[model samples]
Target: MPLLCHNGRFADTLDPVLAGDNPSFKWGEGLFETMRMAAGEIPLMHLHWARLQQGLTRLGMNDAALQRSVLENILRELALRNECAAAGRLRLHLYREGAGLGFVAEAAPLAAADHGWNERGWSIEVFADARIAPDAYSSLKRANYLPYLLAARRAADTGVDECFLLNAQGNVCDAARGNVFVVRGGIVQTPPLSEGAIDGVLRRHLMSLLAAAGRPVQELGLTMEDLLEAEELFITNAVKGIRWVARFRQRTYAHAVCKELYGLLGQPFNNALVAP
Candidate 1:
């Protein structure tokens, strides 16, 4: 099975705008979306597209048709691959240069399953400079991610799974790939959008679900101490879905937040994809 347009149009054969050490690669010129493919189709196609559209516009590269075409092309290609059922990641790369050439890649296998809301957890650390929102513009998930990348790498080196950055005022911001959440007294809380974290689509959906369920949902400022005091803490994204925090620096959380969100999200696939 040849992917839709990947043989002569293959993902492996796809080339980025900069081969050697071009500015974009060197300077982080483009943006990327980490998407999950389940049942051989993107579970939240349009939502991811919406965010990509916003990112393109924020990065001064708006093209609805371009986005759609790249996604359609990749969708076609992925459908042709033999690895659909085994779990995978898709990276849609676009060059900001001339025609905005597209590179759709099918990544190595990922370990993803319905880990149940309350069961999945991750240990995180807080770094001061982990987030570099491309101060040139806003952080549109661009290539310039050395700060966060390096910080996360350091966390891994310290035996932690990931890094959760704090804001200028020492408030817990977000994780490398997902948003952060804290639950105290069974009330769910996350940092406000003004806190300089990427506005995650799935984060919004989860907030709405909690809000509708009458579970406490707060978008207030959260601190490292606030996180430590949380009964349970979790991080979220479209792919990782929801991961609980087992440890952060020297403290360990019981991973109550991980289980709660996971249980909340697993009611159905769309439960994670759509808002309540």
Candidate 2:
């Protein structure tokens, strides 16, 4: 059986067993982080916590220290329980506690962690019907994922691996599940956070690595035309380090830059299998 941790407490099951009602479910008042666990430890956890702190602050939730402590303990215990000491995925979910149809009294925040053993190179196309709304909450991985869900459905139905979601301004913001990057003329460019892309942990780390290696990377505007002309395209997420896109509709991409960057990323961790 999979083990789960609910608000610092371990349990044999994953159900929340809420005391009252879950405001996260009734409304979309929740944020989450999906992290990659390597050798029982979460790499780049500090960044994940930093982003989580931002979400908590944005959602008007206090007790950051307590929440971090709870997650830390749960991660350790769950890692051991799941036998994921070598590798796994850790998901942290935080939500406001409330009741009734509308948000009632604001109580202490509730959180949970699902740690599991693991273990995609994706063919992606653009999703056009829905565009993400730019707002304070847009950068956070919140529970309000209707747009992403719809895009994923379209991808599955259309025989593609994933779809890129554009922002309200019709700029490429993110893929269905990760941040998008485009490479043209050996220079890498990704949509800025201003474009409503989530501040992905791997995205930040990979950018830093690229900069340190003296390779040029820019946070700039990206359009469908830019992608069409790019030599390479890729996506980054915490769980999957980096996946070079094989195809985007009629356009195809090469992995020359992705291979170099992927090798650079794996150097420190000794993870040769990260190449995709």
Across 237-264, the per-residue lDDT of candidate 2 in tens digits comes to: 7776777887888877788778777777
Cα lDDT computed for each candidate against the true fold: 0.64, 0.73
Q: The CA-based lDDT of model 2 is what?
A: 0.73
Q: Candidate 1 residues 22-92, lDDT tens each?
A: 44666677667777666566656677777778777777764553747556555645644646433555666
Error of 1 at 274 (Å): 25
Worst 10 residues of 1 by lDDT: 267-276
Where does candidate 2 have its weakest 10-residue lDDT segment? 103-112
